[model samples]
Target chain A: MCEANVYLIDKEGNEKLLLESVDKLVPSDESIMLENIFSQRKTVKARIKEMALVEHRIVLEEKD
Target chain B: MCEANVYLIDKEGNEKLLLESVDKLVPSDESIMLENIFSQRKTVKARIKEMALVEHRIVLEEKD
Candidate 1:
Protein backbone atom coordinates (compact mmCIF):
# COMPACT_ATOMS: atom_id res chain seq x y z
CA MET A 1 0.00 0.00 0.00
CA CYS A 2 2.89 2.37 0.77
CA GLU A 3 6.49 2.71 -0.23
CA ALA A 4 9.37 0.66 1.11
CA ASN A 5 12.28 1.52 3.36
CA VAL A 6 15.31 2.85 1.56
CA TYR A 7 18.74 1.51 2.42
CA LEU A 8 22.09 2.69 1.17
CA ILE A 9 24.59 0.04 0.23
CA ASP A 10 28.22 0.84 0.68
CA LYS A 11 31.00 -0.28 -1.56
CA GLU A 12 31.75 -3.05 0.90
CA GLY A 13 28.12 -4.18 0.52
CA ASN A 14 26.95 -3.01 3.90
CA GLU A 15 23.36 -1.87 4.13
CA LYS A 16 22.76 1.38 5.93
CA LEU A 17 19.20 2.42 6.69
CA LEU A 18 18.40 5.71 5.06
CA LEU A 19 14.72 6.38 5.43
CA GLU A 20 11.57 4.60 6.54
CA SER A 21 7.99 4.57 5.42
CA VAL A 22 8.93 6.38 2.26
CA ASP A 23 5.80 7.44 0.47
CA LYS A 24 7.18 8.90 -2.71
CA LEU A 25 10.34 9.34 -4.74
CA VAL A 26 11.16 12.10 -7.18
CA PRO A 27 14.18 12.29 -9.43
CA SER A 28 15.83 15.66 -9.57
CA ASP A 29 18.59 17.30 -11.56
CA GLU A 30 21.49 15.45 -9.93
CA SER A 31 19.89 13.61 -7.06
CA ILE A 32 16.73 11.92 -5.87
CA MET A 33 14.26 13.26 -3.36
CA LEU A 34 12.42 11.03 -0.93
CA GLU A 35 9.30 11.83 0.98
CA ASN A 36 7.98 9.71 3.79
CA ILE A 37 4.46 9.27 5.10
CA PHE A 38 5.08 11.98 7.65
CA SER A 39 6.15 14.29 4.86
CA GLN A 40 9.76 13.99 5.96
CA ARG A 41 11.96 14.71 2.98
CA LYS A 42 15.53 13.74 2.11
CA THR A 43 17.62 14.22 -0.97
CA VAL A 44 20.27 11.66 -1.74
CA LYS A 45 23.02 11.16 -4.28
CA ALA A 46 22.23 7.53 -4.91
CA ARG A 47 20.64 5.20 -7.35
CA ILE A 48 18.28 2.32 -6.84
CA LYS A 49 20.06 -0.99 -6.84
CA GLU A 50 17.13 -3.22 -6.16
CA MET A 51 13.55 -3.06 -5.03
CA ALA A 52 11.56 -5.81 -3.39
CA LEU A 53 8.32 -4.07 -2.72
CA VAL A 54 6.66 -7.24 -1.53
CA GLU A 55 9.35 -7.43 1.12
CA HIS A 56 9.21 -3.72 1.83
CA ARG A 57 12.87 -3.25 1.04
CA ILE A 58 14.69 -0.93 -1.33
CA VAL A 59 18.43 -1.03 -1.82
CA LEU A 60 20.35 1.92 -3.18
CA GLU A 61 23.99 2.42 -3.96
CA GLU A 62 25.43 5.77 -3.10
CA LYS A 63 27.01 7.75 -5.86
CA ASP A 64 29.37 10.68 -6.06
CA MET B 1 -2.26 4.03 -3.71
CA CYS B 2 -0.97 1.46 -6.14
CA GLU B 3 2.36 0.78 -7.78
CA ALA B 4 3.93 2.52 -10.74
CA ASN B 5 4.56 1.58 -14.34
CA VAL B 6 7.87 -0.27 -14.89
CA TYR B 7 10.11 0.88 -17.71
CA LEU B 8 13.28 -0.63 -19.06
CA ILE B 9 16.15 1.64 -19.98
CA ASP B 10 18.46 0.39 -22.63
CA LYS B 11 22.13 1.12 -23.10
CA GLU B 12 21.25 4.15 -25.16
CA GLY B 13 19.06 5.39 -22.33
CA ASN B 14 15.82 4.86 -24.19
CA GLU B 15 12.85 4.04 -22.05
CA LYS B 16 10.78 1.07 -23.10
CA LEU B 17 7.57 0.11 -21.38
CA LEU B 18 7.91 -3.19 -19.65
CA LEU B 19 4.90 -3.54 -17.39
CA GLU B 20 2.08 -1.26 -16.47
CA SER B 21 0.44 -0.80 -13.11
CA VAL B 22 2.93 -3.06 -11.41
CA ASP B 23 1.80 -3.79 -7.90
CA LYS B 24 4.67 -5.77 -6.51
CA LEU B 25 8.30 -6.51 -7.11
CA VAL B 26 10.08 -9.53 -5.65
CA PRO B 27 13.76 -10.21 -5.89
CA SER B 28 14.51 -13.72 -6.98
CA ASP B 29 17.76 -15.63 -7.34
CA GLU B 30 19.19 -13.57 -10.17
CA SER B 31 16.13 -11.92 -11.56
CA ILE B 32 13.24 -9.93 -10.25
CA MET B 33 9.59 -10.93 -10.35
CA LEU B 34 6.90 -8.37 -10.98
CA GLU B 35 3.20 -8.71 -10.29
CA ASN B 36 0.50 -6.37 -11.45
CA ILE B 37 -2.86 -5.56 -9.96
CA PHE B 38 -4.53 -8.27 -12.00
CA SER B 39 -2.05 -10.82 -10.63
CA GLN B 40 -0.14 -10.73 -13.87
CA ARG B 41 3.42 -11.91 -13.31
CA LYS B 42 6.67 -11.33 -15.15
CA THR B 43 10.28 -12.09 -14.34
CA VAL B 44 13.04 -9.90 -15.67
CA LYS B 45 16.77 -9.84 -15.30
CA ALA B 46 17.07 -6.22 -14.42
CA ARG B 47 18.20 -3.80 -11.78
CA ILE B 48 16.40 -0.76 -10.51
CA LYS B 49 17.90 2.49 -11.69
CA GLU B 50 15.47 5.09 -10.52
CA MET B 51 11.93 5.48 -9.25
CA ALA B 52 9.56 8.40 -9.46
CA LEU B 53 6.63 6.95 -7.66
CA VAL B 54 4.74 10.23 -7.56
CA GLU B 55 5.06 10.33 -11.31
CA HIS B 56 4.07 6.67 -11.58
CA ARG B 57 7.32 5.72 -13.18
CA ILE B 58 9.92 3.06 -12.34
CA VAL B 59 13.06 2.78 -14.40
CA LEU B 60 15.07 -0.43 -14.67
CA GLU B 61 18.12 -1.42 -16.63
CA GLU B 62 18.50 -4.91 -18.03
CA LYS B 63 21.33 -7.09 -16.80
CA ASP B 64 23.00 -10.10 -18.24
Candidate 2:
Protein backbone atom coordinates (compact mmCIF):
# COMPACT_ATOMS: atom_id res chain seq x y z
CA MET A 1 0.00 0.00 0.00
CA CYS A 2 0.99 3.67 -0.22
CA GLU A 3 0.97 5.84 2.84
CA ALA A 4 2.03 9.45 2.52
CA ASN A 5 2.26 12.26 4.99
CA VAL A 6 1.72 15.66 3.45
CA TYR A 7 2.95 18.92 4.94
CA LEU A 8 3.21 22.54 3.86
CA ILE A 9 5.02 25.76 4.78
CA ASP A 10 3.27 28.99 4.01
CA LYS A 11 5.04 32.20 2.99
CA GLU A 12 5.29 33.00 6.68
CA GLY A 13 7.54 29.95 7.17
CA ASN A 14 5.02 28.54 9.57
CA GLU A 15 4.58 24.77 9.33
CA LYS A 16 0.91 24.63 10.19
CA LEU A 17 0.39 22.09 7.48
CA LEU A 18 0.44 18.46 8.38
CA LEU A 19 -1.46 15.62 6.70
CA GLU A 20 -1.03 12.47 8.60
CA SER A 21 -0.83 9.14 6.79
CA VAL A 22 -1.77 9.47 3.18
CA ASP A 23 -2.43 6.41 1.04
CA LYS A 24 -1.58 7.39 -2.50
CA LEU A 25 0.42 9.63 -4.83
CA VAL A 26 -1.34 11.21 -7.75
CA PRO A 27 0.82 12.31 -10.69
CA SER A 28 0.73 15.88 -11.93
CA ASP A 29 -1.01 14.85 -15.09
CA GLU A 30 -3.21 12.42 -13.27
CA SER A 31 -3.82 15.06 -10.66
CA ILE A 32 -5.01 17.36 -13.39
CA MET A 33 -7.08 14.61 -14.88
CA LEU A 34 -8.50 13.96 -11.47
CA GLU A 35 -9.03 17.63 -10.78
CA ASN A 36 -12.74 17.19 -11.20
CA ILE A 37 -12.58 14.18 -8.95
CA PHE A 38 -10.68 16.22 -6.41
CA SER A 39 -12.13 19.67 -7.05
CA GLN A 40 -14.69 19.29 -4.34
CA ARG A 41 -11.82 18.28 -2.05
CA LYS A 42 -9.85 21.48 -2.09
CA THR A 43 -7.68 20.34 0.77
CA VAL A 44 -6.43 17.38 -1.25
CA LYS A 45 -5.97 19.53 -4.32
CA ALA A 46 -4.14 22.20 -2.35
CA ARG A 47 -1.90 19.53 -0.93
CA ILE A 48 -1.19 18.31 -4.42
CA LYS A 49 -0.38 21.86 -5.55
CA GLU A 50 2.16 22.24 -2.79
CA MET A 51 4.05 19.23 -4.03
CA ALA A 52 7.77 19.25 -4.80
CA LEU A 53 10.92 17.24 -4.39
CA VAL A 54 13.47 18.36 -1.85
CA GLU A 55 16.33 16.04 -1.02
CA HIS A 56 14.11 12.96 -0.92
CA ARG A 57 11.75 14.80 1.36
CA ILE A 58 9.10 15.69 -1.21
CA VAL A 59 8.83 19.13 0.22
CA LEU A 60 6.30 21.79 -0.71
CA GLU A 61 7.84 25.08 0.24
CA GLU A 62 5.87 28.21 -0.47
CA LYS A 63 7.42 30.40 -3.11
CA ASP A 64 7.38 34.16 -2.85
CA MET B 1 6.26 20.37 2.88
CA CYS B 2 5.88 16.83 1.58
CA GLU B 3 4.60 14.76 -1.33
CA ALA B 4 4.49 11.01 -1.82
CA ASN B 5 3.85 8.47 -4.59
CA VAL B 6 4.83 4.95 -3.76
CA TYR B 7 3.50 1.64 -5.09
CA LEU B 8 4.33 -2.06 -5.16
CA ILE B 9 3.04 -5.50 -6.21
CA ASP B 10 4.56 -8.99 -6.03
CA LYS B 11 2.79 -12.34 -5.71
CA GLU B 12 0.08 -12.59 -8.29
CA GLY B 13 -1.36 -10.59 -11.14
CA ASN B 14 0.35 -7.52 -12.50
CA GLU B 15 -0.84 -3.95 -12.63
CA LYS B 16 2.25 -1.82 -13.19
CA LEU B 17 2.53 -0.30 -9.78
CA LEU B 18 3.68 3.23 -10.18
CA LEU B 19 5.40 5.80 -7.96
CA GLU B 20 5.01 8.73 -10.16
CA SER B 21 5.31 11.86 -8.03
CA VAL B 22 5.91 11.65 -4.31
CA ASP B 23 6.71 14.52 -2.00
CA LYS B 24 6.63 13.23 1.59
CA LEU B 25 4.80 11.28 4.29
CA VAL B 26 6.90 9.03 6.46
CA PRO B 27 5.64 8.37 9.88
CA SER B 28 5.78 5.07 11.81
CA ASP B 29 7.70 6.68 14.60
CA GLU B 30 9.62 8.94 12.26
CA SER B 31 10.37 5.93 10.14
CA ILE B 32 11.78 4.25 13.16
CA MET B 33 13.80 7.31 14.02
CA LEU B 34 15.20 7.64 10.55
CA GLU B 35 16.49 4.09 10.76
CA ASN B 36 20.02 5.07 11.66
CA ILE B 37 19.68 8.33 9.83
CA PHE B 38 20.54 6.23 6.79
CA SER B 39 21.38 2.56 6.57
CA GLN B 40 22.58 1.43 3.19
CA ARG B 41 19.10 2.30 1.97
CA LYS B 42 17.02 -0.77 1.29
CA THR B 43 14.36 0.36 -1.10
CA VAL B 44 13.04 2.91 1.36
CA LYS B 45 12.72 0.12 3.86
CA ALA B 46 10.64 -2.04 1.58
CA ARG B 47 8.35 0.86 0.95
CA ILE B 48 7.61 1.32 4.59
CA LYS B 49 6.75 -2.34 4.96
CA GLU B 50 3.77 -2.36 2.63
CA MET B 51 1.68 0.02 4.61
CA ALA B 52 -1.99 -0.97 4.47
CA LEU B 53 -4.87 1.36 3.60
CA VAL B 54 -7.56 0.46 1.14
CA GLU B 55 -9.63 2.78 -1.11
CA HIS B 56 -7.02 5.56 -1.05
CA ARG B 57 -4.58 3.18 -2.78
CA ILE B 58 -1.42 2.68 -0.72
CA VAL B 59 -1.05 -0.90 -1.86
CA LEU B 60 1.92 -3.24 -1.89
CA GLU B 61 0.30 -6.59 -2.27
CA GLU B 62 2.61 -9.57 -1.87
CA LYS B 63 1.59 -12.38 0.35
CA ASP B 64 1.26 -16.14 0.32
Candidate 1: give the clashing pairs: none
lDDT of 1 by residue, A8-64 (tens): 987777889999988676654467788887799998987656666655677777777
lDDT of 2 by residue, A1-64 (tens): 2333456666676764344444334433112111122232213322223222323223334443
B-chain TM-scores per prediction: 0.86, 0.25
Alpha-carbon deviation at A2 in model 1, angstroms: 2.1
In the range B1-64, model 2's lDDT, one tens digit per residue, is 2223346565554644445334334333122111112121213322233322223334333334
- For model 1, the stretches where C-alpha displacement exceeds 4 angstroms are B1-64
Q: DockQ, per-model, please?
A: 0.25, 0.12
TM-score of each: 0.57, 0.30
lDDT (tens digit, per residue) of candidate 1 on B1-64:
4567999987777889999988777655477788887789899987666666546678878778
